[model samples]
Target: MTTSFAQVMIFLGLGIGIIILLTAVFRVHAFFALLIACFVVGLGVQMPVAAIINVTKQGFGHIMQSLGFIIVLGTTLGVVLEHTGSTKVMATYILKRIGEKHAPLAMSITGFIVGLPIFCDSGYIVLSGLNKSLCRRTGISVVIMSVSLATGLYSVHCLIPPHPGAASAATTIGVDFGRLILVGMAVAVPATLVGYGWARYAGRKFNNEEPGQAPVVDLSLPTPSVLLSFLPVIVPILLIGIKSFIGIDANKPVPDWAGLFMVVGDPVIALAIGIIMALLAVRSWKKSTVSNLLQEAVEKAGGILVIIGAGGAFGAILAATQVGQHVSKVVNLQALGIFFPFLLTAVLKTAQGSSTVAIITAASIVQPLLPALGLDSEMGKLLAVLSMGGGSMMLSHANDAYFWVIARFSGLDMRPMLQVYTVASLFMGLITLLMVFILSLFLL
Candidate 1:
């Protein structure tokens, strides 16, 4: 049965509305809400009952299979760094060199680099304490540092590879992964700078001081060296970037030496290696302290893993409906040019509050229309991935986990969160879209 465009819109709207209602209004957990949304969309699209079940299972399993271990390893690495004071060491080193006046920029750069390997939530958690310390020491507004870091983390999280969102989008759209990396980096730097600019402006305008006393970091503890502190975050990015350069493909023969980099460069393995390095870097701590930290890391990772799985399931169900194919047939998306992908992804991200889901679903929708949209070329495909990524950054509000991570960790009230972090994301996303549009003009 052919689903009409209007019908598809209804199904899509119902699905997204239910998710927003459940998560934002009724206060349901995102995991349950996303699962419910999958069923709603499936049923609304009139998918068979049996098919819905299978699709849900396949979607959940596929996402978990691809990303579960990577997420866990990344979280473990984050936990190890957070507990071991490595995050603080790195923050302090950067601040000391740059001076306190540029604390926001320093934190932003730190977030940009660290977020390459770590999830934004985990990165924020790992650095929030250090953010507070920097704020206290420098009298810089915590709000400024918080938004700057959030923006930095988010810029790469949405744009760059080794981040599951961008990588997954690249794979889904059949773009060359290595090229996506280069394009994403080019886009991310400008997006991050836009974020930095907003954070600086917002920091001055909204002066809501942190309410409570800052947590005292122990100065006497034997912290890891700055170089050691960096290895967990840096090594994986370098290896992965190198692997992208090597260009592995099933059709071509790869060198034996390249094999080692491939093994180490896989996001899961690279982060796992990071975890091992993180553990070693903190080896001097008491055994019980280490044990507690590991346990805590596991506990924190549980919620995020569930949300990711649910998001995957939701995306799967959307794919099953073939809404993108239908939309491609109905809309003259080519007329809109580069803005088409960006607008579509922005709507998806704003509705669902998961950038990874937004990227995956948008890429799927855009893939079928690539030729029609003049995005069938190599460079065009990269731009499409980036345009979608830029859109994914729009309006990260109550529903986004990263939003809460920024709000809770940085101790901002709801009003401030909306004003600072949420608005900044919207601005940053627009800036990124502008950059993508300009790039498309040249590349296309």
Candidate 2:
């Protein structure tokens, strides 16, 4: 059972290489790929077969227990918003308030807010029509509009909770979910704006043509009012934020109302409240329509849940090797500090192309080394989680499904997308990392 640090490190690298090979090169499902990688790492590290299975199961179950309900509830809210036109209503409301001259900024803000409850790809799809319509009406290049929206969505998906990556990473790294959400939202702002700026410049330089007419939306259902449309997203954030603030100074005597915060402001409960509010968007709550929509949300969340669970399994197997302790003694990765997680996640993301997988794996790999890297403090761990989130945003390219979602939906050719959107992703991630770094100086 004893293995050299070099041996363990080699096996770890091999296991991750297999993940990238299966997922990226062979197009294997990440769940299966990650599971396979887990076994590879476990067996290579000389773990007993039964122990590997038990650890894998425990890891997967742990992640599901902590983060599963939140993901499902959040996905349900997103599905309800998408199907019921709440997403469009929010977009239109923002556009009206911001005016056509500020269309890209409006779209960026819309994507950021809407993306908080959903995956980036789904968020982009839900808003793509609005992006196209705005591009046509405002005479801004579609590239600008699409990149603006895509980057906004991308920034939050990588950082904010209720999105699988950030949630799972928070669970793995032992960071408070509410605090991560608050910090992530703040950090995401600069990244979103930087991405927006890059989009504007790239649009002018690339001059990509607009897509065809915006797809006609089904107008059968009454669009929800702007306040109702925003309620689901806003209420959950406020509840969670209040909980975080209440807990900030633990020495302060717990207030009598803290019990309520403990109940409604828990991330899972908050998301459940959001789902209940989202149900208001349904015009006719026929059992059949409601059932189907809930089913669709489950189907969407199912894929994400399994993938994140497998990532947890993969992390567990790696953790079992105690490679982090070994690596810490050999190399002063502590010196790299925050950049270590960021760079590691960036590599995993660029290689295998799933931000969720990248962040989860990086969190698993980094967890044991937290003490070694002088990041074992509460705030330090959060910055590490955010650092991984920042790294996961970079270098999205042809392999990323979200990239294609933006390109095809926005009518940008591959080269133009690579030039504008892909490049913008780099800057967005870097800017986010920069923000995290700055926060680290103050908080850490």
Off by over 4 Å in 2: 212-216, 251-253
Q: For candidate 2, lDDT tens digit of each residue in 1-444?
A: 898998898889998899889988989999998999889889998999999999999999998998889889989989888878999999999999999999999999999999999778888887888888778788888888889999989999999998899899899989988899998999999999999999988788655486744455664567788899999999999999989888888778868979799789998889988988888766567788789889999999999999999988988887889988899889997799999999999999999888988898888898988988878999999999999999998789988888888877787888879988999999988998899899989998
Candidate 1, superposed: residue stretches over 4 Å from native: 161-183, 206-221, 248-252, 285-291, 351-382, 398-419, 442-444
Cα lDDT, all candidates: 0.78, 0.88
Say which candidate scores most in TM-score: 2
Each model's backbone clash number: 0, 0
lDDT of 1 by residue, 232-337 (tens): 8777766666776776455777788898987787767777788888878854667777788778877876776686677667777877777767767877867887
Q: Give each prediction's root-mean-square deviation over alpha carbons.
A: 3.3, 1.3
Candidate 1 clash figure, as a count: 0
**Candidate 1's TM-score:** 0.85
